[model samples]
Target: MPDVACPESPVTPPPPDTHTRSLSRTLPISVLLFTVVPLVIAGLLTLTEGAQRLREEQELRARQTASLLAGRVTQLLASAQRLGQAMAVSPAVLAALQPPASADRAMDEPPSRPEVLGDPWLALIRSFPEVDRVELLDAQGRKVYTHPPRMQESPPVRHLTASQPPWYPREDLGSIEIGLRVTHDGADGWVVVGVSAQSLARALEPPAQDGGELWALLRDAQGRVLMLVRRIAGQPPEVQPLPVIEALAAPDARSRPVVARSALDDSAWSVEVQASLDAYRSLVLAELLRFGLTVLVISALSAGLAWHFARSLTRAIREVARAARAILRGHYLNAHVALQRDDELGLLAQSFNHMSRQLEQRERERDVFGRLVSPEVRDQLVQGELMLGGQEVEVTVLFSDIRGFTRLCEGLKPRDVVLTLNEYFTRMTHAVQRFGGYVNNYMGDAMVVVFGAPTPDPHRVERALHAAVAMRRELAAFNQERASYGAAPLEIGIGLASGTALAGQIGSPERCIYTVIGDTVNIAARLEGLAKHESGMQVFMNQATRDLLPPHLREALQPLGELALKGRGTRVPVWGLPEGAELPEPPAHLRRPEEEIL
Candidate 1:
């Protein structure tokens, strides 16, 4: 074919084979989305529901077990009470409560073998498997007779008068005495019974394979646990009282009636049950297996679907990723991804554009904030600036107040007063900053500044004194300037003190201000007040600041010896500087004992 002259046109490459590999990638992604995702979600739900059900079942089982065990203990307690009541009615026990015929015999005298009441009582107690020991006490709480004399002296018995009945405290078998009123039986003494805790423990033993543990305790109204028995073989029998559990026991309706009480003595007894969680271990294992199988099946299906869906999703994601990389490289306006779908992908593009705008806005705001606060301070705030703790630091605090700001404001327009004050602050702030002090805050016409904060300066006291002097001098110069303008000269009183203070940002997390709190700041404020009180001085330095300065500098300054300050118990030595004196060197110590100076 003859070559024909063709119109000039750019050769366009065939549509970059968009469909050639599209199906290849889309198929796997579709399979993953349809199969694996649903399976995984189903498995998670199954596992969660199964675990919850297992917990509920275990809790219900525990409650049931505790109730049953508590019932058994209740029965045993009731039996013990019945036995005690029967003993009260026994003629022999009643006879034992009477004083012996030979009242002349010493209380400790052993009853003649034939006359002793303990032998018969011992015989009777032995007949009952639960009675470990029995004893008799006289009105004086002395053990007149015991089945077995285990010790040289019975542990001191708590005296039980006619008003108090003889009954065992349910918690322990420790030496307990209860009075049996002789009046009821036509006698003039009391009888005490001591039962062995071991016998009670044996009596209250629970069934062997009951799947729960049971404990029996005897307590006084005070809720002391005197005896405890556990169903578990290897567990030690506990005799110590459980106050917390006992408190709960009394308040709970289900537990109150079952917890026994002795009618004769008014002593209380209780039982506790704790079901073993292991009781339902088999059920849990079975449910767990079912959960695991369901999870495995669902996970397999979900993963497959996810893998297939991921392939198609990756195409749109890759486009966004490529544009993001371009934007990160500083091509802010040169890069954008085409999000053709009206789904999450399109929303993401919109969000990304919004994020770009927000990021620019933040940059501008940061610049403005930097101007408002010092760069270092702004950085600290933005970067979690502090450890949120206070520290004792050597700081020089300065308090300055306009001498007659309120009076001056009355004469001038409000705007004029504000303008003049603003001008004053500008000059004072510049001076303070020059001396490496931070203006802590402005309180109406007063300004508080701290040296050696945020960052410490070794010569903080000297710097603060220098700043205070400079501030007064600047005020004079400002007043002179105002005088030329036909305005009254402004005067300010300044106070400076140096000492240890707790300095840090103080307030809530949402709003906080850096400040110092301590006796030093208070003293500085007091000195400022004193400045107004002093005859010819506008600045007052407390003994603290005066002592901090060198002796030569101290000599140059005029001392206002021992002036009493408000709220101070004793007079404080104060000093003032002449209108013009060279700045003094800081003393080694702000305070020294009078003897040391001598």
Candidate 2:
């Protein structure tokens, strides 16, 4: 087949934006659209969904409350029946039933064996405070016993029958009375107890703080609302049933009520809990108000943050450009950008600063060393073969962090805090140097020191321990001075670990740091954290570090047990030295002090 030349596809250009906007102006508007607009839309949707959810929750709550009330009512009835059954079988009631000696002998004469019934009735009333009255009637419907001896004639024995409903309204006495028919040893009568309607009404009413009304109805087997009880928020219970309960139960357009039914034995009785629709609406409104306010505050913050970010970004860029121009004009020392941020832009600013510093250092070297060394010698010194990677070397790492430094600084001015840290670090550095240790890094209120790094040391572990003890001694002296000035004393926790780690200058070509890294460094840091929380001990070390100690020194160390440190899978055994524990004096040649360091 002959090869045919094919035409290349034309590249399509994007549509031009005639009007370009500055980031400082575009950011706030874009943020408002992306953040505020979405938030507003979400708020509206949330309000709608929240209202529906709240309505459903209220209905569910009403159903649960109604069910609870029904359970309570059932319990009340069951208890009353049990009490009645027990009273009917009592000897006192049976004695009262026995032919009341000489029934016709004297109408007003004190009834024989009155004390028998009287004692039992009084005891029954005393045992159950809710029992308003304890009444015993005979088979002939004759009232035989009453808790409180009645002076006048007792009300006609109306509710003393087995055929009557178990529970009935005592209109004459203004109470709801429930009775149990008793037939024991051929003795038949009714054991009746009266319960104050108001008490029962109060039990059915919801708590006032709930901001809802409760309406409890007691209906007959025929579904007639026999007893209606109503309670509004912050109001006493209403035991009197209105002529029509439907009027009281009528709900508004927004009303949603939950109805629950419970039957007492065979008695068809139900309890209904109707939470106020208005209360549900109020709750939903309150929640929406909080949501709206939160959204408003967040939107405001987003806009402010966007504006600030745009302004800072542009300002930093401008500063860098200006500095670049200055550097081009041979003003390397003066060309620098100062920015305070932890983000990418901050890194850019830092890079610029590093570049300026390197340039200025090179310029100074040329000016000062130019006359002394040859051009070739100067070049070799300036651009030597740098160790760009790390090497595995056994070193003893010491990590120390100031305890309560944050709290201490809270009470001191920023300048005073800086001065205090400088003084503290100065003493600590002297202590480490006295034991032939190099202070590696200062991270916030923490310090990392290394022994046997960049220089071989056979006794690195011993030196690290000596340095830790010296640091403790220095801190005590420092604290005494602070106490004399009525200032708060500071405390520090030290952790030492000895192991093989990657040690060398590590970083980008622009900026490098000679530091150690590996599991040993991590263990030291973790131990440092643990020491701060440990009681009686200010210094801690891993088992590996402790293993290197001599028997005499090891005997003084307290076991810290196996600990599950973070970022490590296995539990590491640790040892600690009490604050009062001291090591033997160092060799005469190793007795260099702060004065010698100075």
Candidate 3:
């Protein structure tokens, strides 16, 4: 079969994109530190700390106001009880309760006459104006006489035993009933006074600025709402049975209620002072207004200070940002921030300048290095895949020489010589890199390349062989272009050998380089020299490389009779690949290793 270029493998995969520019613009760091961060923090503190403090103050003031109102109600009830105690033992009250001469006389009273039953009790009630009505009960709990009787008949107060004289608050009558026992010479009786609810409200009100009108409730031990002061018009004449007055109000919309237990002897009643939350609401509003003002003042001052500090940083930072934008556009410029201060911003600017210089140096080195090695090898070295120390590994060595270059250069100008070699070497280098081969060194007019050093390739032999063939073919086209430029066409000889080799960083620490070295490399160099002398061919492959080629392309090689080389002890099988030729393979033979031309 005629010599043909190997089928093109998939193009070498590019390294992944690790970093990219953000598409959306964001707030600058200065703004974040100065205005935004402080605002957010202040708002959060105002909501949490300010609100909590206001709520706590409201709760405390409500409790204090409730206690004051409770004390007032207790005082009112205590005074009424004192009057009842005095009236209980009065001679008039005692005489009035005694068995009368006739039942008709006891009941006899002109309908038009409304005089006090007796002056001793009347005078006492007049003195204590809160005591609206008074009644003297017989030992059997029957009403004997009542001053200004509300009803023709009234039921006895329950929840009061003979052994205990109880203070009862009646919800149905809207009054407080105080019961006191009389024990003079064993003639026992009970004096009960019904103090009006209207008088109780007057006594329950606190100081004008303290809070709203205090509505007081007297409850028994059973948590019942027994009496409500000011139960007159538009008020519920009776308090319903419930655990607390809140049960009567809509949920979360009731007055703040403060309570105090009765100081009376029986201790059966309690006074609750219920008032609106308007006073506490006012207090909270005033506190919040002050807090808001403080926040505004502090925020303004903080922002100004923050900007002062941030301005120093932002100058350097903005320069860095602009420099980065230039780098993204392929202009590797430095920030060059000339901050004179010995602060972090100054250090940052210095670091940026140093990095920019490093990047500029690396760009030159990368271009020189990449021309010699595939990007895959570059990435492998960068990622530390190949350690600095040497390791034994199999690799393919390809050596190519510019044929007739020494003679061709003698007739050309010095500038032409360099331009020709540069163009020729560049084209050939590209061919090798396409097949994962790297140009390791340039020996005058000759080029030395290696396959699978930094990154080991299992198919190194075939790749080297393919790259050699590609280089041979690309040279023909390059020659045509050179002829058009009024320059002589170019030609080169390639020799490939593959075997176990020592491959790693090969030089001193100051200028270390990754390379491959062994007899395999030596043999490849010898093969190229032999191509110039004996057969003067375009490409040649040693036995080691020939064995690895695919069987179909192996037929493309033509066997030239074995020739003794300069140094080794054996004669080796050799094959030739002249460009555009159809060559038939020779029968297999295991020739002894000889100097293929040492």
Count clashing residue pairs per candidate.
Answer: 30, 0, 2
Winning candidate number (lDDT)? 2
lDDT of 1 by residue, 27-75 (tens): 4345535554455567657766766675566445444544444454445
Candidate 2 is scored at a TM of: 0.36
User: Residue-wise lDDT of candidate 3 within 1-598, one digit each (tens)?
Assistant: 0111211123333434432533123236544345555555766576667557755665565466556656766777889888877776667666555544677864554231234255655676888888877776655566666677654546643234576635666554446778887656445567777777667656544434344434556556665665554232233333333454545432124444333333323465555544455555666677567766766777676777776656565555567678767666656654344556575555655666666666666676666555445565555665556555689988889999877888888877899888888888778877777666766777788888888775678777767767787787788899888788687776677888888888776655444666677888887877776766756466777887888877876777777656555566777677777657643332222111222101
Give the clashing pairs for model 2. Answer: none
What are the root-mean-square deviations of the candidates from the true structure over C-alphas? 19.2, 25.1, 23.0
* Model 1: CA > 4 A from native: 1-108, 112-133, 138-143, 146-190, 194-270, 276-279, 308-342, 362-598
lDDT of 2 by residue, 59-126 (tens): 67666766776676667666666677777888767656654456574243334234655555577567
lDDT at position 136, candidate 3? 69
What value of lDDT does candidate 3 attain over all alpha carbons? Answer: 0.63
Point out the higher-scoring one by TM-score: 2 or 3.
Answer: 3
Q: Summing lDDT over every window of 10 consecutive residues in candidate 3, give the lowest-scoring window.
A: 589-598
Work out candidate 3's RMSD over C-alphas.
Answer: 23.0
| Residue range with the least summed lDDT across 10 consecutive positions in model 1 | 1-10
